[model samples]
Target: MSDFFLNIVEDEPQALSPEKVWKVAVIDDEESVHQATKLALANTHIMGRKLEFLNAYSAKDGLALLSAHSDIAVVLLDVVMETPEAGLGLAKAIRHDLRNFHTQIILRTGQPGYAPEESVITDYEVNDYKTKSELTRTKLFSAVYTAVRAYQNLTSLAAGREGLRKIIDSASTLFQERSIAKFSEGALEQINALFNINSDGIFCVSSAPKNPSPELAQYLTQHKHVDLSEVDNDFRVIATSTGYRDLFGVPLQQIPKKEVRQLINRALTTKSHVIEDHHIALYLDTPSTWQACIYLHSQQDITDKVDHEILKVFASNIALGLENTKFLTQLADTAYKDDVTSCYNRNGLMERAIPEVIDSNDHAVLYLLDIDYFHEITEALGFEYGNRVLNSFADKLKDAFPSDAMIARMHSDVFAVIVPGHGQPPIKRLIEHCSNQPLILENGDALRLGVTIGLSIHQEGTQADTTPESLIRHAEVALNKSKEQRRGSATTYDESLDAGSLERLNLLSELRRALSSNELELYVQPQVDISQQCKVVGMEVLLRWHHPILGNISPGVFVPLAERSGLAYELDLYVLRHSCSLVRQHPDLPPVSINLSAMSLDRGELLDDFASIMERFHITTKQISLEVTEGCLIKGNSALTNLQRLSDAGWDIHLDDFGSGYSSLNYLLRLPISTVKIDRLFILELKKTQHAATLLTGIIGIILNIGKRVVVEGIETQDQNDFVANAGAEVVQGFLHYRPVPFLSFVDEYKSH
Candidate 1:
């Protein structure tokens, strides 16, 4: 059966010139009608192309043919084909369902009553509607010719739009290339897209001259492109398309084709384009003494003057584009690279070097190094010596690491290096070498320095998308740990080291929500007068956070985080305003004391905000007392000035957490504080040993002798209370006297009394 089918296929006729024919589909139910149509248009030709008719017997066959051939230019349809309106239905399927809007449809019907011409043209989107009786040979020829012309225009517009889109996409890609070679290749691709041609080409660049302009010199210095001018001034192929790819990087004189070389030399000498019958060459000059040329080959002869003009414009633009790319490259280098150490700067390491290293290697380790006690060196010696030490250390880094390794100066006295794999032996050797060698200054002074190193390794076979920023941050965290535990040692990053940071971030976010949502409240713990039969002298206001998701966040955890995050100032303001409003509402309550953050003293506007809040609530400075830590007194003259302003404004100041940090007795005389609260640590130790009582007694006696009211805190036991009461403490604050309570509860218990 297969042999018989092959024999039948061999007997069929073949087209004379298939490539030069325009496809036309003829759909009808009668065989005679198909033969009649073909015979009538047998000698027909339009736009120098002959018609090749495709015959389909029924609507089903016609739809199948339309679906199989998307390039069909026109369709001639009979209205009644096995159904009353089969041809109209097929037209709708072609126009709507298949979305083949490019193909023109000409509907021909024998009976006008079956499907009206006006209805079919308007509803089915057919190009033309004609009755069979009116379609003679002359009219049929005109109808098909008109339809084919419309299809041609539609396809032409679509092709033009596609070409324009490709050009736009290529231009975007060309601007992102960093090197001349890459830029040349991108320009070649875009030029081919613009002309809708796939011809072969070659891009060549001549060497630049020595001692370029100052602008070019600055660019070259920043980008490290000075080596380009060192080579001999000869033209070399930088990029090529398809057949000419083997010519890349080859000198012009060594090219095998003498004719191509002669054409290139002619264009270079004249500094003008050479247009030929089947080829074109363009010459371009850059801002420097460098020149570039492009040679393109085509099969057809050059014609259209518009195309020639566009080619010239494109060439000029290519020259401008090259200069713009050079400027941008230099700008990027200056932004990210450090000129002093010839290493990547902080921006360069994060944006360029780190990404390249991660892309090329499977596993790598990042080392964060810092010069220990660098400030002391600068203070003792001069800044000149400090700079010399930094330069010497940078040299040591370059000598120790491989060429492919990324080295950068993160900031002052801090350098970072990224190496492959997770080994410790090389790092140990590097440290020993650095320690043994001392940097000798120009003044003949040898300075010995120590370094702290932190290492973070990205393991193999892990997630591929880990960012360099996160790795650097983790390494810095480890470096901080090294500095705290052992100043001159190295530590590797671990997941456990990130717990505190992660928790702090989560708590900060929750604290912000708490402040905005009114979840923060003040709890007051009363301070009793021990000599006045345990009378309630005053109440200390404490901050409390009630979070919806994490429940109550302890003041100990969130307060320090708030201070470090700079949110302590806002929290302090909130406490001040709310406490003052409460005291104003219930005048019978004792004087309230609120603790201020040490960070608030550094801010120049703290006093102003405090005064504004007090005036807004119609409360006086005497009604509220501010408690500041001992650390604030020794910060600077600014803190002292702020405190003196508060004291002059009739506000009472009390020293809080005394003797905890830098416990200098000088603060008692220097600060304008009316009361002192001994640190809880000293109060807890009063009953533990004999030295504790003697020390506590002596400290309380000294404060009383100085005429400053002393308040002993953290009295949990009766013995502790009795000792403090007899030891000359005017007031006591602890669980033994009263625990902290909410504002409403405190008002109900004490204010009603």
Candidate 2:
């Protein structure tokens, strides 16, 4: 044996558990064999566990012994016993019948002829094969020690696999929690499952505590229970299996347990993990608002019982996950909370109220309040003053509604409230307060408010439409309906309000298809110069849609649809494309005026794109006239910028829809416009009212004084035509002279003339 144990020095024995022993079974036909095996292995030790031998002389006795003691680590068997294959039969029984796969079976033969075949060692559940003559003292010792050590390694591998499975399951549960409080509550249970430690745990956090009381915190922890008051303070026991949930507004050193405090402090100082004796203190890198620690009080020796490397990796992963979760939480606050008003924004309101409203199907009332003429207010005052007004408005709403009401700033100039329960909300009181009382600003300015409210009551049957977004929309529709009758009024949602919305949806879909198809046509209305004996001064191009199934669809129906559905830009491009094509065909036509929307004026192919299309059609600026409304005169707006570009390119600009918009006299002189068309509203007013001419005379004179031609529209009567003719408006356009004709038909008639 090469003197393997001649100078072996044994160290002091470990404080191991009594059950930690390597069990061995000695089975043979002879009594001398059992005595020899026992003497050889009596002093043997492997992996801190000494060999324990159980003896059975015959194969029958060995079978019984092996079956009874399943944990026996190794079996020494004689191949030739009372029967020729008796020892082999016992090996098969230990493997199949007893299902003792972990036990190592070593076969021995006294005679060379009795030695088992190589197949018996390879496939008959035998770990080793040896002859009795070769079984010296050293060989026997080496064999027993090696087999016991192999058994120990197999058990360790199985334990490690189980631990890894537990970690996977625990990590899955931990990763799903988004809030810090929720994550902390789950950590104890998950970690216990991960490490297989039967223990009580405490999760402490110092993050964002409210109304802290250090005295109460100390008393509660000492008493083994805490009320909600103690839980509201700092250094709180956020989660615990059994004991006080204290909250202390002090340092982490104020933790009640001395050993836990030491471990937590050590971990923080080293910026690493700390494990000791029967307790483990895991310091987590939480948000800047809080420092946290999970302290486990385990009864079993945990430090050396679990895998150290696996714990370190999971700890690192857990820290990374917490940091990520806190980051997302901050981002969520930014996304869902309004910065200017400190109210829940649209998304926040939806997330908070929708699910509850759906689940309860409770008697809930929704209120949408719009600040009437709010745009004009913002325009008159600066944007800074607008913010102050909004903040003051939000404060008044909070005062007006109940404390339990869920309120939010839905959008600019629009506020919402969701009141649950069957009580009548004090909405009338809120309106009167907003209207009669003056909102006092920060700089001691008192501004009178005009509030318009729309309400929707949701109950059991209406749960389908009780979604936050839908209810808010219904409330807004009612608010607009109220505004149509009066600026400051309240209205409740009705089923009739939905008819127009449904129609708009159907038309919007069809309009999208019309833009690409041949269903759209352009018509030109003649603007005649009165002084020149009704000579056509210019032609204004208007769009008309011809739906295949619906037959003539009016521009009034689809024009607003185009604007609302973001198809105005494309429709404007369609007009410009066809207008340039017309002037290309009929070169002798009067300057064709095509009305452009505010959106189209800014974003349409007016600058570079207009030039390119006109260049392609071989048309000049003199042949095309763009009609703009008062919206184009917003000084520094994109529409004005595009208008300046068109004027710079020598294209004639005409102010259309003049009296309908912000009809400022300043725009008449400041803008690069050559002609102005009075809206049809003034013409109808002139025929309906007594003093309408006075208004029309002054408006026409202003355009005339600016050296800009005035076109009086909707002059269907002879009296109306002569009235404008004498008023020196210069040009007049209406169905009385010529209804809008197709551009091609007008061109054909002009060519015939």
lDDT of each: 0.77, 0.73
lDDT of 2: 0.73
TM-score list, all predictions: 0.61, 0.65
Candidate 1: Cα lDDT at 532: 91
Give lDDT tens digits, candidate 1, residues 639-687: 7888899899888999998878888888888779899999889977765
TM-score of 1: 0.61
Candidate 1 worst ten-residue window by lDDT? 1-10
lDDT of 1 at 311: 62
Top TM-score hit: 2
How much does candidate 2 score in TM-score? 0.65
Question: Worst ten-residue run, lDDT, model 2?
Answer: 1-10
